[model samples]
Target chain A: MKKIDICLTPELLHLYELTDRIVVVVDILRATSCMTTALAHGVEKIIPVATLEECRALQAQGYISAAERDAKKADGFELDNSPFSYMQEHLKGKTIAMTTTNGTLAITRSREAIQVIIGSFLNKTAVVEYLRSQPHDVLILCAGWKGRVNLEDTLFAGAVVDELKDEFLIEDDATLGAHTIYGCAKYNMLKSMASSSHVKRLHRLNLARDIEFCIREDEYQVIPILQGNALVAMVKA
Target chain B: MKKIDICLTPELLHLYELTDRIVVVVDILRATSCMTTALAHGVEKIIPVATLEECRALQAQGYISAAERDAKKADGFELDNSPFSYMQEHLKGKTIAMTTTNGTLAITRSREAIQVIIGSFLNKTAVVEYLRSQPHDVLILCAGWKGRVNLEDTLFAGAVVDELKDEFLIEDDATLGAHTIYGCAKYNMLKSMASSSHVKRLHRLNLARDIEFCIREDEYQVIPILQGNALVAMVKA
Candidate 1:
């Protein structure tokens, strides 16, 4: 059986051999959630940049800029890290250049993988289905806050593992731990995450609704996958 | 109130500030458990080295050499990674030089902290008591198997968080997640860790009794604290 593993944070990515694996990059509070939401709602594609300057540079090419740092929108960006902003009708068919403190960095760092895909609660079912159809091992990479492990991303990872456990070999402790955390939090994720650092960080910025929206299951059916330099919605086969 | 955090693996240690923190280094499957047992049973001191060569060199200075790699004792070493060996009556007053894949590396890497201490299920109560008396932030550093996270050490870290939650500000997701994992696994840790990677590795080597002995709570009342270059049991007032 193929293996399903989890890298709790990007800093520990070096320990894994990503060569033949399908990497599911998750940043549940936002980032990947926004990308999943954006694509599902009609945004053409997303260009995930590592820095705000790179995101800003793409604006000159007519791409919409979405940037966040420390839980707030970066100055001069056209959009912030929220799924609601990406769902606006005006953004249909628009290309977005995005950079965030954690999520974008995780996506860029995972370029070495055979396949890099965005994962979030909004697109969990789609991600599971996509992985179920593939023949390679899966690595759930949680984009934790600034190199630190966070609960929300891990919960999303666990949710996927719970769905795929019967079909995949759950061998690593990180995956087991994430699966257990999901078992505990799936009943009332928002309440379970009331004490989480990232939840509190976003709540202080009045993004509680975004947090709620991010954790809602199966809100979208699209998977944002890396294609060369940009992320495009993978066409369902 | 002081803050309590857990660094799940040593590779993530760079993300944390260790200069003024009290680092609790734990390798529950063997290394730290052996250190605590040795010090509690009248062993003079343990010199934890990162490499087997360092441990072998200390053997020339009349110190007993204990080295483990990939869960087996090194060929030329006098002692293996079992707590029972340290419990023997013949080892009294002997100084041990130890090296292991995970535990010793964690101890040496944590030298930057104001205080470096060894913790395991063998001395969980003593570790909590020492932390309660200290005025600095606590960072439970799990010596994961070769920089990858493991269930036993994370559960041990969670056990400590459960005891000290009310006394400390459990701010990070790692501590909160660990506390939750402890809540789920405390009732039956061995079974919870049956599927753990390291447990299966040691069990294949017929070290099941060592695993059972390592998780026994409060078996030792001693807290092993690092002083200069050796670990010696702290005197309780």
Candidate 2:
């Protein structure tokens, strides 16, 4: 059996030997979720830029733009990082130039991996199905909040791990750690993590709805895969 | 009141503004714990080097040396990174040089902070008491396993937050996150985190006793403080 592991946070990355693995990048609240939703809702593709300047520059070439910072939609962009924003009919058939605080950085970091797929609760089943067909080792990259391991990303990784456990060998400590956290929080994830610093921050900013929305499982069937600098929906191979 | 927080892992570090806060480095498995035990048992000041070569050079200078990698004591060192090894009567009154994978790196990274202290469950009460008296903002630097967040450090940070909750306002998400984990683990910390990746790895290596020893609260009254290149017991002001 091939070794499959999850890096709970990007900082745990140094321990990973990523030469032959298929890396899945997850930022559940709300980068990957937004990307997955946008693609599922018929947005053409997403250009994930690491910075606002990159998003604006991409938008200058006439692409629609979406930007987010601190979990809220950035001003002057065509859209925000919220999944609700991506569910609009206007976004259908449009290409989005998107930038976020953490998720975009994770995608950029995993460019060296053989394959990089975006994983979120929004497209959990699709991502798992895609991984099941591939014979490569899997590495779930949790795009934790601003480089810190937060609850949502790890839980998403756990959700993936729960699905793939029978097929892959969990090799890393992070995978085990994330799974343990997920098992502990699965009953009432939002309430269990209510005191989480990220949750508290979101609550303070009046973004509690976003947290509740992000944790809903398998809401969409689209699997977003990285193609060069952009993420597009993967067609069945 | 200024915000005092500790990043339990480098991943969660992105949320912290490290410019002005005092960061106390803690890695109970077992760098900080070893350092506290060494100082408490009457060992003369200890030098924490980042690499084995640095430890070797200090060893050549007639200083007793210790080094650890991946939770195992380094080969050919007089002392391993275990707190048990440092509790020997022979270690008393002798200056020692030490190096480990995570804790030392944390200390080096936080060298620019206004002040740095070593914290562990063993010295919990003393550490909390000392932080309560300091005027500068406090940040707990959990020298996580390698560069990732580990359970013990975050649990210890939560203990600090729980202790200092009345005196300080926790502003960072990492702090809030640690407190949540602590709340979940407080009733039976060992059981709650018994399956943690690090703990399981330690158990597999037959180091379960070390985990139990490391989590014992208030076992040592000594609080380690960083001064010049060494961490010595803080002489209470």
Candidate 3:
């Protein structure tokens, strides 16, 4: 069986051997969810930059920009990291340059893996199906808040483990822990996440609608795979 | 109100502020359990060193050396990391020089904190009570397996969160995650840990007794607090 593991935060990514693994980078609160929604809603591709300046510079090259910092929209950006923002009718076929506090950094850092795929609850089934058909082991890299582990990302990783347990060997404590947590929270995820720091943070910023939208399972049947600095929809084999 | 946080691994310790907080370092599979057992069995003090060479050097100075690597006893050490070894009558009144793959490394790295204390299921109540009376915030530092998060340690950290939730503000997701994991595992911990990688590793090495002993609640009523380079039992007023 192929093996599955979870790197709880990008800061601890160095401890895991990234070679020969399919890295599923998840930032469920907004980043990956927005990317999934953008692709499914007909956006051409997303350029995930690590800094605001990098994202801003892309605008001069005709790329629409979306940037967020500390759970709020950055100044002068066309859009924040809300899934609803990506569904705009005017954005059809337009390429977006995006930068967020955690998700983009996670994508950039996972370049060493055999393949890096974006994962979130919005397109969770598509991600599981993609991994099921792949040959390499899987490492769910959670883009935790500011390099600290968060519940929403961990729960999404756990959902993947629960779906792929039969085909993948759960070899690490982190994987098993995620699976167990998912089992506990799958019934009432919003209630389970009531005490989550990210939920609280988003709630304080009046982004509860974004949280609800991000956690909605299988809302989009698309998988965003990182390809040469851009996240494009994976062509199903 | 005081606050409590769980640093899932020492590698992520940099993200947390350590000053003015009580750092409870736990390696529940054996290291912290052994230290608690030794201290409760009348061992004078324990000097936790990072490497085998340092522990071996202390042996020449009449300190009993205990060392472990990858769940096995290191060669040339006086004892392994099993809690049972610490219970031997001859160990009484002797200071120990100890090194382990995970636990001691956690202790050495947490030196920046205002207080560094050892925690284990063997001394869980003592650790909880001590933290209850302390004025500072608390950080439960798990000595994960070689800087990667492990279930046993994470569960122990969660146990602390569950017990102290009413008194401390859990403002982070890691702490809440741990607390939830503890709730899931507290009923039948061994069964909950049947899928844990560390549990499988220990069982493969015929160390089931050590795991059982280590997980026994309140087997020892001692809190080993670091003072200078030695861990001595805290004198309660």
Please tell me what DockQ candidate 2 reaches. Answer: 0.34
Per-residue lDDT of candidate 1, residues B113-206 (tens digit): 9999999999999899999998999999999999999999999999999999999998899888888888899889889989899999999999
Q: Candidate 3: DockQ?
A: 0.85
> Please, what are the lDDT tens digits per residue for candidate 2 over residues B1-237?
857776767545556776677787888788898898889899978998999999999999999999988878889788887788888998888889999988887887777787878988899998888877777788888888766667777778888898888789876545765676677779998897775667777888898778788888888899888899998888886
TM-score of each: 0.98, 0.87, 0.98
Model 1 stretches astray by more than 4 angstroms: none
Report per-candidate TM-score of chain A alone. Answer: 0.98, 0.94, 0.98
Candidate 1 residue pairs in backbone clash: none
Give the lDDT ranking, best first: 1, 3, 2
Q: Write the per-residue lDDT of candidate 2 for residues A1-237, one digit (tens) a residue.
A: 867787866766767877788999998877888888889899988988889999989989999998989977788888877788888998788889989998888888888899899988777788898889988998898888766667777777877888888888875545765666676778887776776666776788787777777877788888888898778888876
Candidate 2 at residue B35, lDDT? 90
CAPRI-style grade of the A/B interface in model 2: acceptable
- Using TM-score as the measure, what is the rank order of every candidate, best first? 1, 3, 2
Native-referenced Cα lDDT, model 2: 0.81
lDDT of 3 by residue, B45-148 (tens): 99999999999889988888999999999998889988889888888888999999999999999998999999999899989999999899999999989888
Model 1, A1-237: lDDT tens digits are 999999999999999999999999999989998999999999998999999889888988888899999988999989998899998999999889999999999999999999999999998898999999999999999999999999998998999999999999988999999899989989998899998998998888998899889888898889999999899999877
In CAPRI terms, model 3 is classed as: high
Better of 2 and 3 by lDDT: 3
